[model samples]
Target: MQKKYVTIASFTAALEPGILEETERYLAIIILLAGFKRYRSWRVPIAIYGSALLFGLSHLGNVGWNGETFEATIAQVIGVMGSGFLWAVLYLYSGKLWIPMIFHFLMDYLANLQSGWNSAGWQFNGWATDYISEVLMVLVPLIVTIWMMYGKRREVLEENADRLMNLPVEFNRY
Candidate 1:
């Protein structure tokens, strides 16, 4: 007799809910105005954070898919904002889309497995625990975003220091 258990294929079955979805959505957001190229300098922060917020907002529809009530949906949206922050920061820091895409894939994959795919909503948890999760989801991302942004700002400043200090441009042969 064969023992029934989850397999890796189970995780890979749902493509739309993970990396592919994130890639499509993020590209949609960035491609319109050449956001990757046009937004530079201090504007980069605004663009990243703003797009992240919109990314969270875009998931509002998933609440309905999860069969969550409006209140839970609101909480979920707040929680998703945190995830958006994390993903945005990941992409911004690496300057690579695949980093966040792969992370998003793992996140959704584990999440669906944990929730058994059928009930992948905050409503599945007790009210208190669900609320706590929502709050934590928001806070964790907020903290990471702040920390990452501070370091990123410093790096940007250092890179620009030569120009700001009117130093001569240095070129390297590849």
Candidate 2:
């Protein structure tokens, strides 16, 4: 049985404000590099994906945290990346932080139930099968997210282009 404290902590971590910290950090970087004028139009997707990747990579420390081997860490990292992307996309699509927060909580709850604290390697018996499952966990959501995001991104770009083209000449004075 999973420890109640661990489970609760894990679930809480999933919904923690720190989850969105990367987005904030990345947004600051994007603003510094691209400025607010380009932030919505060009930097949004970049910040989304970039922060997701960084969020995923940050969890690589879980190897040490969980005392897992490097190989297992790699597998888990792939899955983490997928989860990060899925949550980020959800936030972007819904324009609501709560949506992603709930999903993240569920994911972390499930993960903790399966892996337990410091039981990363022991959670699975067959190493190869575990690795495959981990990879799939990442790939399935990532592929679907990319497909959905692509369509939405195109729509946003087209809308922006039309709005820009239709703007009055005097609007450029700013």
Query: Could you tell me every candidate's TM-score relative to the true structure?
Result: 0.69, 0.63
Best by TM-score: 1
What lDDT is reached at residue 56 by model 2? 64
Q: All candidates' lDDT scores?
A: 0.59, 0.55
Off by over 4 Å in 2: 1-42, 118-126, 152-174
* Residue pairs with backbone atoms closer than 3 Å in model 2 (clashes): none
Best by lDDT: 1
lDDT of 2 by residue, 1-174 (tens): 356646556656545533454355335334432443344445445645665677667656756555576766776667667777777666555545567666666665565665554324424445688878887888888786668545555454334323433422221211
Query: Stretches of candidate 1 above 4 Å error?
Result: 1-14, 28-41, 118-120, 124-126, 152-174
> Model 1 reaches what TM-score against the true structure?
0.69
With candidate 1 superimposed using the best TM-score fit, by how many Å does residue 140's alpha carbon deviate from the native?
A: 1.2
Candidate 1 residue-pair clash tally = 0
